[model samples]
Target: MGDWYSAEYPSSSLHSLQGYRVFISIAMILGDGLYNFVKVLGRTIFGLYNQIRDKNSRSVLPVGGRTSSPTDSLSYDDQRRTQLFLKDQIPIWVATVGYITIAIISTATLPHVFPPLKWYYIVVIYIFAPILAFCNAYGCGLTDFSLASTYGTLAIFDFKTGYMTLASPRSMFVSQIIGTTMGCVISPCVFWLFYKAFHDLGVPGSQYSAPYALVFRNMAILGVEGLSSLPKNCLTLCYVFFVGAVVINGIRDIVGKKWARFIPLPMAMAIPFYIGAYFTIDMCIGSLILFIWEKIDKAKADAFGPAVASGLICGDGIWTLPSSILALAGVNPPICLKFLSRKTNARVDAFLAS
Candidate 1:
C-alpha cells in the first residue's frame, strides 16, 4: 500500500504508461490469486478432515445423556433460516457488474486521483478482480495476512525491470497508486487483519509507528538524486557503521544466548542514530524494567506482563485523539507537574502588578 502511494506522488513519466498498467494489473492478479487459491484449498481440505475426524470420534463414544446428531446440533428453524439467507444473498454477477460500474465511474470522474484508464487495464481488472477477492478472503480467513502492500511493491519493481522504457519515476508512481488502490478494494483481508492485529491488541491506529516510511522516502530521494547528493565523508561513515553493526551482531549470535545478553543489540545501538534520544531512553527504561521483572518471577512476568505493557501503550494512545482535538482548538492540556511548569515568580509578580 505504501509502495503504491509512493509511486503515484510527484509523478514523472520515465516509463511507458500502457506497459506499466498491464504489468501492475497482471502482477496484482497473479500474486493475490496464488495466495488465495492456496489458502482456500488448505482450509477446505482441513475443514472436511476435521469434520470427518469429529464424526468418527463421536460415533465411537459410548451412548451418553447427550448424543451428537444432525437433529441435536441445529433445529429445523435454524437450518431453514440459514438456507433462506443463502438463497436471498446477492447474485455474483450482479455484484460484479456493480463493482465494474463503480470502477468505470471512478476512472472517468477521478482521473487526477487514479491513473489514466486504458481498455486493457479495465479488462484485466474486471477479469482478475474476482480471483483477487477470493484469494484475499481465503488468505485472511486462514492467517489474517493482507498482501496489498507486498504485491504492490512487487508490481512496482517488476515494472521497473520488465517495462524499462515506461519505468520513469512518474509512470512508476501512477502504477503503484493504481495497483495499491485496486488491491485494497479487492482484498477484505486488509481491513479485517488491521482490526484483528491492532484493535484487538488494544493499540490505536494513530499511535502505530511507521519507521519504514521514513526509510523509503530517503531511498526514493537518493535514487532520484544519486549518491553524490550526499556528502562523501558522511556516506563513507554510513558504510563503516553499517558494516561494524553487522559484524557485532554476527558475533553476538555466534556467542550463544548467555553471552548474547551482555552484548548490546545492533538495532539498539543504531536506533539512537535515526530516532530521538528521548524516545530511545524511554524504550531502554521500559526494556530494563521488563528484564528485571522477568528475572525475578519468570512465570508471573510471562503471564501478566503483556497485559500491563498493553495497558501502558493503550493509555498513551487513547488520550492522543482528544488531546489532538484540543490542541487544534487552541486549548492546551494543563501541565500538572510543578517541575515542568513554565510559570515563574517573575511572571506571577508581573501579573499581580498588571
Candidate 2:
C-alpha cells in the first residue's frame, strides 16, 4: 500500500487525492461559467432586437418635406445602421469568440488554474450590456419599453447592492444567483427527502396540492390553525397589489419622469409573481398529467419518462430566458414577451402536450 503512494497523486498518506474528484470540480467550474455566459448572452440579444425594431420603424417615416440637416441625417443613419448590425449579427459573433476564448484558456490552464476574468466579464456585461439594451429600446421607439434606465438599475444593483433590494433594479441576476446557489445547496437534501417520501407514498404531480392539504390538515388536528380558514380573497388582494405597483411605476416612469424610483420596486415585486405564476401553473398542470398517466399505465409511464423530462428544456428555451432577464432589469414581462415571442406559444403548447 505504501508503494501506491506516488508523486502523481496530490494526496500523500491518508488524504488520498482522487482524480475523479479533481475532474468533477473542473467540470463544475466550466459548467457554471458557461451557464453565466448563457444568462448574459440571452438577455443581451433580446435587448438588441428591441433596439433594431425601434430604429426600423423610425426609418420608415417619410423623410418628410422638411429639409433635413446634414448632421441630423448622418446621425440617424449611423444610429440606425449600428442598431441593425448589433442585433442582426454582432452579439453572436462576440459570444462565439468569448466562449472559444474561455474553452481554450481553461484547457490550457488545467487543474492549477486561475479564472481571473470572471469579474472582468461581469463588469463588461454590467457596463455595455445595458447600454446596448437601451439603444435597442430607444431605436425600437416603444414608449413603454424602458430598457436603458432599467438596465442601469440592474447594473447598479448587481455591482453595488448585489441585488438584495426588493424594489430597486429587480436584479434578476441577483435573484438567479440566489436561486441557483440555493438550488445547488438545497437540491441534494431536498431530492433525498423527496425521493424517500415519493417512493413510500407514490405521490404524483396531480397530488401536489396534497402536500399543502396535508400540512393544513395536521395543523387543524392540533387546533393550531389561524388564517387558513379565512374566506378573504387573497388572490384579489394580490391582484390589487399588482395593479398598484404597475400603475405607480408607470406614473413614475412617464409622468414623474423618475425611471429609477418607479422602475425598481414595482418591477421587483411584479415580475417574479407574474412569470413565476406562469411557470408554476405549467409545472402543476404537467405534473397532474404525469400522475394521471402513471395511474393509467406504468409501462407507458416508463416509456414516456424521457418525454416528460424533456419538458424542462422548454422551460429554459429562448423564450423564458429573455423574459426573466428583462424582468430582472426592471423591464416589464409583458412588453418583452410581446416584443420577442421566441419559441411561440404554439411550441410551448406542444411541449406540454408531449
Candidate 3:
C-alpha cells in the first residue's frame, strides 16, 4: 500500500516519463525484493541480449575491430565473464547478511514483543547499510570483509537508539531539520491543494456510486479526518492517489491530453486482495513469534527496544490486527463501505437540518 509513484510529474513529456515509468514498472514488478531481482535480471538479460544481437550482426566488423585468423584466434576468458559476479559481490552478500541479521536480532532482542518491530529500524538499516556498502564496494575500495565489521556494528548500535549511529551528529541534525521542514510545510500544502480541488468537485448524492467517488471522497476525508480515523483509509487512498496520479500524469504527458481524466480510480472497484494478503501475512508472522519471545524474557520485557516495539502497536499494528481479524472471517476491509457510511450519514443529517 506504500506509494510506488508520485504526482506533479511532467505529464506532457513522454521522454521524461520513459525513465520514470521504467522505475515505477520495475517497482511494481519487484517491491522489497527489488535489490535482489531487478539488479540481477537487468544485468543478465540485457547483457545476453546484446551479446547475441551483436554476434548475429558481426559479418562486418568496425575498422579497428580485431579480426582473428586461425593462429591468432581470440581466447575467451571464462573467468573474466564471471567477474561481474565478483564485483564487490561479497559486500552485497555481507550487507544483505547485515540487514537480515540485524532485522532478526532486532526482532529477537527487542524487549517487548507483543506488537511487532518498527519499520523505522528497518528503514534506517536499509538507508545506511546500502550507502555504506556501496561506498566501500566501488568508491573507496574497502574490502567487503571490513564492510560487515564496520556497518554491522553501526546497525546494531542504531537499533538500540532510534537513529543511525554512524552518521555524524551534525549531519543527522541537518537532515532532521530539512525533513521537518518538508513534512510540516511542503506536505501540508500538497495535501491541501488536492483537498480543495477535489472538494470543489462536490459530487452530489448517488453520483458517489462511481469509482471516482472513492477518490473524490477520500481525498476530502484524508485532508480532514481525525488523526485516529485517518490511518484506516490512508493506506489504500495513498496507494491509489499516488499510483493513479503517476499513471494519469504519465499518459497525459506522453499523449498531450487535457486534465479532465485525472479522476481517481474507485477503491471499492480495485482489488483489495494485495493489502488484505499483506496484512494477513504480517499478522501471521508477528503472532507466531512475538508471544513466544515475550514469554522467554519477562525481565527485559519493557526495555528500550521493546518500548519502541510497543509504539509500533500504536501505528501499523493498529489496522494490521483488525485487518487480520476481518481476513480470518473471509472479509476484506470495507474501505468504501466505511466511507459511504460516514459521508452518507453526514449528508443526510445536513439535509434534515436544512
**Among these predicted structures, which one has the highest lDDT?**
1
lDDT per residue for candidate 2 within 177-233, as digits (tens), equals: 687787787879755755554444334233222342332343343244443322234
Worst window of 10 by summed lDDT in candidate 2:
150-159
RMSD of each: 18.1, 25.7, 24.3
Per-residue lDDT of 1-354 in model 3, one digit per residue for the tens? Answer: 124323342322211222232223222222212232345567899989988988967666456656555434422332332332233223457646867887767755653563555656655765665544443232112111112221111111121112212233334445656877767897687556545544433333322123233433443453466433332333454455446534643454455445533542122112112222443455446545656666887545423334544465457637855764564455754565332457668997899999
* TM per candidate: 0.36, 0.20, 0.22
Sort by lDDT, top down from the best: 1, 2, 3
Q: If ranked by TM-score, best first, what sequence of candidates would result? A: 1, 3, 2
lDDT of each: 0.50, 0.42, 0.41
Encode model 1's per-residue lDDT on 85-109: one tens digit a residue. 4444446787678888887775566
Model 1 ranges with Cα > 4 A deviation = 1-221, 333-354
Error of 3 at 156 (Å): 16
Which segments of model 2 are wrong by more than 4 Å? 1-231, 259-264, 270-354
Go through the candidates in order and give the clash count of each: 12, 6, 2
Candidate 1 vs candidate 3: the lDDT winner is: 1
Score candidate 2 by lDDT: 0.42
